[model samples]
Target: MQRKRASHYIPTSTMELERLYRLLVLAILVNVVRGRFLPGPWIYAAHATFYGAEDAVATMGGACGYGNLYQSGYGTETTALSSVLFNNGLGCGGCYQIRCVNSKYCYPGSPYITVTATNLCPANWARPTNNGGWCNPPREHFDMSKPAFMKIAFWRAGIVPVAYRRVPCVKQGGIHFNLQGNYWWLLVYITNVGGPGDISKVSVKGSRTGWIPMTRNWGAAFQVFHSFQGQSISFMITAASTRETVIAWNVAPPSWKQGAIYMGGQLG
Candidate 1:
């Protein structure tokens, strides 16, 4: 007598299927509420103006202490944020997606451009807020590079209404640290960061020393007045928005020198 074979399919109870569907829907709703899935609904209104040459030559060595924009990997796709958004250099490295909303000045296809916040667009008290003081308090504005502005609107527009939203940065490689200052005072400029891009805090560790918190010197640079000479250096960087930490082990060798750039592990 042949034994009965077990069924190939296990039937799922209707209650269980309903529960799973509800869970899936809840997960999607959570992501949407957190601004992770759809950022389009979170877009904000702003105005944008352009400055510098078409090649963005004049935008180099900006307020962010990025030195050479090209060398820092920011290139022409960069922007100077208004004081409200700049937050005293803390906004450096943050990325934004901008699109011209003015039909009169918007490009034919209403193209959108992504830019890194690399500088501060200072407020001009000399001009009226509605006139030339576009970066005045409480107003969100972007002073984009000429090349970046042209990507979304006509050059002759001067300024255009725009819609923008914060977005994660997409970088090509690992994070970069440009060493500056002397052995007694170390200034490290962090760049090419991924994810939220902006750093909230930084801690440094050496082969012979424990972790030491570094202060924000200026822009994307951090500083520590302790000597770490002759010891390999590691970094613990905290993201501004998420507060997530990334440890880059042995980012610089013991023989690291000033003006040298070292590549470290990346953040998501």
Candidate 2:
């Protein structure tokens, strides 16, 4: 005699089938809420204008402490955020996807372009907000690099309506810590951070000392007055929006030099 085969269970009654369907739907919803499944990026209304030449030379080393767009790995795809979005330098290093919309100057079927926030587009109190003061308070604006603007709209438009959204930054290699200041004062300009990219809080630890919080010096740079020379240094960085923390262990050695950039571990 052949062994008895196990019957495959299936819902037969209407009530049983409906209950199974409900459970399936609930499981999907739970996964979505838990971020197991991600939705599309949220779109926001804004305006954009170009400020620099095609080479984007003028866009480098602005409000953000990250010097030299090329050396910092930001390249020409960068923007200067208005005060409404710059958020007192906390917005630095955040990435955005922007596209021209509802304008004749918008390129036909133009794909959206991604840019890193590297500077601040200051408000001009002398001009009217609707006229010359595009970066005035209450207005969300992007002062994009010329190359970035040309990707979506004609430069002659001067300013164009744009739809934008925050996106995770995709960076190569690891995070970079550019060491500055003297032995007594240490300033670290962090660059090439992934995930949300913008940093809110930073803490440093030395081989001989406890963890010490660093103050935001400007843009992406953080400063600590205490000296940590002749010891290995570690950093704990927190993301601005998500508050996600990433600890980079022993990022700099005792032989670390000023103006030199050291590679720390990256965040996701």
Candidate 3:
């Protein structure tokens, strides 16, 4: 009889204790609500507590905030998506990550990466006519022209005889160039014209058509500043020459490291 009694008895384990506790709580809940407890309200509350508030905050934040991170050409939703895309370096064609900046507008072919901005105030923002003006539109692009300045500077101080003749062209060296605020300054030593004729007529024509003339030119120097994509600059020298006029050019390479200037004019 003792063995039978022991066999009939079941042990209460830790898990069983938990189960009993839950059941007891359920009974208390059922009595409190009088069998009126509904799962629909609980689920609704849970969802609203998280998702609903999240959506509300996002909308409010967007309205108040100046901008947000997003994919180029897409809004905030796209920005979030691009974070994943760029991290994978997807569709970049094996290019390693160099640098990235957050801006609304992006230049095409710029080595650095960019993030799109979502919102902007019209009065404060300056929009580009073509594409990729910082915070303008068509957001996210690479701009080769945006790099720091590299320059080529030559001086008339030193001289080296070429073919046993003292040449007007003297010491030539290059320096890095930077686009100054609204103007680029260039100094060149030239003969074949008097009164230190201005070369200010020089202009840079981008890959896209259209030319912007130099603002100031004096002392055989030229000053020009225009939006250009590291293209060829045509320097038209308006000297008081009889017939043959001196015209030269300089090609700004795609790589900002190399700056070149061509000085071609026969001094009489």
Model 2 clash count equals 0
Model 1 stretches astray by more than 4 angstroms? 1-42
Error of 2 at 207 (Å): 0.4
Q: For candidate 1, give the lDDT of residue 161.
A: 91
Query: Per-residue lDDT for 1-268 in model 3, tens only?
Result: 3445655645469888788889999988764433221211101100000011212224112211212212111222211111221222121111111222122121233232222212221211454623223222322222111111000001121111111101111112321122323324433322222211112234444445465555433222345545444555444443221122333444343332222334333212
Number of clashes in model 1?
0
Candidate 1 TM-score over all chains jointly: 0.86
Q: What ranking emerges by lDDT with the best candidate at the front?
A: 2, 1, 3
lDDT of 2: 0.89
lDDT tens string, model 2, 65-155? 8899998899999999999999999999999989999999999995789999999999999999899999999999999999999999999
Mind sharing the TM-score for model 2? 0.86
lDDT by candidate, in order shown? 0.88, 0.89, 0.26
Model number with the top lDDT: 2
The model with the greater TM-score, 2 or 3, is 2
Write the number of the candidate with greater lDDT, choosing between 1 and 2.
2
